[model samples]
Target: MKSNRGRRRDMQIAADNGDRLSKLPNDLLLNILERVGTLDAVRTCILSRQMLKLPTMLSQIVIDLSLRDLVRMNGVVADVTDKILSARSPQITIHKLKVKFLLSPSRCLSIGKSVARAMATQKLDAAEFEILTPRDFQNCTEAYLLLFAAQLNNFLHACPDAFAGLTRLHLQNMRFAELDITNILITCKRLESLCFVECDAGICSVLNVEHARLVEFTIAFGEFKTVELSYLPKLQRMTYNYWPCDDNPLVLGFVPQLSELNLTNAGLSDKTLELSQLLANVHTVRDLYLNFHSEKIWVRPECSWVLAPVLAQLRTVNLDNLPEECDFAWTMFFLEAAQCLEELCFTVWDHKCCRESQKSFSKKTDVKWEPSSIHFKHKNLCKLTIYGFQSDKNFTSYIRRTMKTAVNIQEISLHDRKVCKICAEKFPQMEARPSSYPRTDEEKDSLRKKIAAKPTMVASPAMIHFPS
Candidate 1:
């Protein structure tokens, strides 16, 4: 039913609109180019003459050179990188550059040299390099390590001025000698954030960051080892997660500006005492997180006495996987010392202390443990959370004692399978309490009835479970 003339006019109008819309602004088109992979972006050049010249507008570059790809392309990979770097006129100012690859020792040296050369000429604000290969790390020989370290050293030395304007840097899965990292830190004087993930070298590395203006530092050691941290003077946040090594306690002497510290899966031997001493010396820390996993550990008792004085300034504390043999007395002493404590999370493992109560009940004995006493007072205590609770008289008594001691307590969260009705009856002034479990409709209705019977100050109970 359509006339040929009408059909042709409609087609012409749609083509005109498509042409107008396809011509995207330079910035918008560059954003689209950045989201695609390098190979895909290169393929876009063949789509049209306009796209042929659009690759130059990219200000961020990511190079992923896998071992298989490298073997397949042979010399083509390096050539492409060289061509890409050369094509940017007036020296492209890259905001970020990321390179990831698996390389042989010889290839690593060549790539490191090439990267150093590029860094020496390019103006980069941030950079990340990751090398992951099982062959390079499988019982690697000392000679191979030295060869890689030497090449990395040359690369770092070549770009001493490149990191002067950098704010972030991440280096992972690379083997570097002690002096290699030391030189990098010394050269990157303005780096504010630095991360070293799974980097290992023989001999404990010493980081001298006194002159560097670093704000955040995170180190995750693949192998159990120690690295010195005594020279960081301006660091604000530090996170350390590593396996235990036989190295001495890492001494942290001049990090006076630090405010937050997180330690996960960290083990301390007699050096635990040294860490306590160092914490006592720090006057600026406001938050501390400790996650311990070992049992029969007397580390806390020894450290608690030394850490008591410093606890006065702490505002928050989180303790996870606390051992059964850990002296609760020392823990209470430390808690009392925290005069301004606002939040507290205490998690015990395996319900060790609660089992004794069960045994006593079966034996028809009236044995009861004394409530943990407080020495210093927490005037600002408002929120308290306890995990791994059991339906035992001992735990109920502990909860009752906490409610009696905390005068300003406003919220309490108990993470347990079930709470004794007597314990809930005793705490009649808590607000905003909730459980971490699902309830049937009937049970939910019953809970609502019970809540209606209670006063507004007494909140409904909540359930919390440990992860499997």
Candidate 2:
């Protein structure tokens, strides 16, 4: 045992000597240090002389503090920031700092001040500050807004030069009005991607995005009325949403080079022709999504007259719950007009009124229902998906007729509410299947045998497959 202990100590000493002799390159050591957090990277400096210089080579830094850490430690925020700044080399560029402050107003302000101080010395590429609190801003007083504005001013002052090189900006749940956002956009010359969530600003405040390089923009309004998107020249993708408001029409215009457009709950009256008119002007758009949540979405016979010309250029169309009897003639007209149509998606609401109307049509109409008439045959059409299929006699008959007409359709997908056992047994490989159906007898028997063979099987849930 004495001899073994002496041998072990000698081997450890030899390994230490080898490590000291074989020093890693600075670039390689920095790469290893970059994998760790800012705190860990700074901690590594105490390991050895070579590692003491590792933190200085760090180009990227991330700082995250827990809510408890903010409250427990008196000057931890300042101390950490000082250490990071001391270790940062002037040659290092592209610093990313992320701080999560979940504490009282005073503490948050202090942390913000420390971050601002750090930004003054470091060449920060991007700075993200997130405040995760459950405080509702709706009932907030003027005092709260003033405090927020002061904090934001401090943050901005700290990183005055930070935004000069920033190409992407994402601000979420920050209490700000339209004017503040417009000012920020003006300063951010190279801003490419901007996202604003749950921000309220008045209608007259036009969101003028003058950044010529702006590519993607997303804005969500909670209680704002009237939005204009006319000034963005280089904008490519845009998502605009508005809450229900009776005061003004959510106006959307401009973006000539836009390839993708998404509109959710756009407060347009059922009788209004503005939506059709807006669609008419977006001639350069290749992909379009329009979701209407109004109770009345009936399309008049003349709807095709207005919509057909605009939709003719669309490659993809997603229509959600238009009026059930929304002029089938107009539907046919739009389908026929969309010459470049590749994929078609249909979502129907299973309403009692719609079912009753279909029944009434079956009783009164003597005209033969041709399957080919319903089958949308576009030369480019290859894929068709139908949702809300309720496996009723009328629906099944319509499917059969429609399938016969889709000559170019290579793939068909259906999401049925209820599955037919017979159909599941017959067409297991088909793209269309009922949602609820029993597994094959062989599978059931196999599961039963496994359960009987092992008592542990009873403790586990059985696997089941159901089509959607």
Candidate 3:
């Protein structure tokens, strides 16, 4: 019921005092916006003119555009991205910039320009660029090759000095040769972690990664003849997954601090590729993970042939899909050498093919698992776990053998495949049956009952666990 003039004056005073967030400085406002989210902060532009530029103050910018989005937004995504990067204040540094887009020749230029501009102005802690092409690019002929080549060339060349301040960088689907990678590594002097996935390394016969400050590195799905990892004193973690290395051994040198190593699908099925020389320089590694093909021996289990350096400090070891019938040569070798091993895990793949494959392995017949040997005492091994356990006689015997020697063993856990969510989710076809492949439920139940009927063979005070 106040007069109109009085109401106008009150409104003007409120505007002068500023809105709820108007009292905060630009940095504090940006911090609030960052915590609230970029989308919400952008919406605040309607509330006041000052907030129209709030999104540019964000330290982390993630732009993801796909084919579906390109149709609806009609390529406004790139323009908006450029504008956001351009508007960002030079004083405010970007911590992370992750951009994922479907690759196109025109879009590649825009992306390269935006990324280069952003990197030029800000000190990025981490940057990830993912160029995903359509799965059916083979049908497109020369267009596919042209698009990929243009994108890769423009991206790498455009940002020569961009990665100097970056701590972490991830590149996906990039086709770079040895010289290209060396240039990137040289420019990224402070890079701590680097990852390449599905990258084309076909042009390079030998790639040398010698980074002084690099701490962690990963390469997957690459066709490299030889990869030399040298002079990386601070490297702590390394992963080489599905490496189609073309029968070339990895050359390792001067990585004194490398601790954790994962080698999965290493294509080492051939007997000639010995692991001893490959792991000779990595004696300092503590955690090791190896996933070998079911049909082949990634590492030969011949006791007479020394295959690896003794890892005295190895605390954790994880193996996948080990042949159940084979002699525990690898297991025995690790246990004998790794005096400080605290945990051991085996992911058993319970399938009919694995059983059939085990029968063909001739080494199992010659080698005998004699747990009574005086060298079987392992006092440091505390926890042992087996996933996808079918409670087969061979596996149970192996477990019983371990329990007898591990005097200080704390726990022995055997997880059934039927109850394992990961196994069921990964192999839905296998989930139709309860136990071992090609066996009936009644037969499996009988086998389980018979196994359970036996007296618990645990000698030590170790806790024995089985799935309910």
- Measured against the true structure, the TM-scores of the candidates, in listed sequence, are 0.63, 0.59, 0.72
On residues 1-468, what C-alpha lDDT tens digit does candidate 3 reach at each position? 999999999999888876867667888887777765344456675588767777887897766555566446425656666778888888887887766655565765676677777777676667766556554333434444445545655655665554555567766555564477787788777788888766644544567889999998998765576778978889999998776654654677889988898887623334434446666777888998887543344654433235335476689999876544444434665676677889999875533333234344343322333223465688999988887666556676666667666667888777765344554565565433446531455655554344334354344322656543
- Candidate 2 TM-score versus the reference: 0.59
Q: Which parts of model 2 are misplaced by more than 4 Å?
A: 1-154, 172-178, 203-209, 246-253, 266-275, 290-305, 308-313, 317-337, 345-376, 386-406, 415-468
Best by lDDT: 3
**Position 129, candidate 2: lDDT:** 51
Question: Backbone clash tally for model 1?
Answer: 4
- Give the runs in model 3 whose Cα sits over 4 Å from its true position: 1-54, 64-77, 90-93, 103-106, 115-120, 134-150, 174-178, 266-268, 302-309, 323-329, 350-373, 418-462
C-alpha root-mean-square deviation, each candidate? 10.0, 12.2, 7.6
Quantify all predictions' global Cα lDDT against the true fold. Answer: 0.56, 0.53, 0.65
The best-first sequence of candidates by lDDT reads: 3, 1, 2
Colliding pairs, model 3: none
lDDT of 2 by residue, 1-468 (tens): 559889999999987985662287877777777777766777766667667766656776655655455456535654665566566766677456655544345555565555555557766676555453323456545455445544554555554444434566554445555467666676666677777655544433444455677788777654455555656778787787654454333444666777777765522443432446555556666676654432233222333446567666677766554333332223333345566777766655323222223232222211122223444454666665655544344444444333344445555555544334654454455444233222456644453343234442222213221135
Better of 2 and 3 by lDDT: 3
Find the candidate with the highest TM-score and give its number.
3
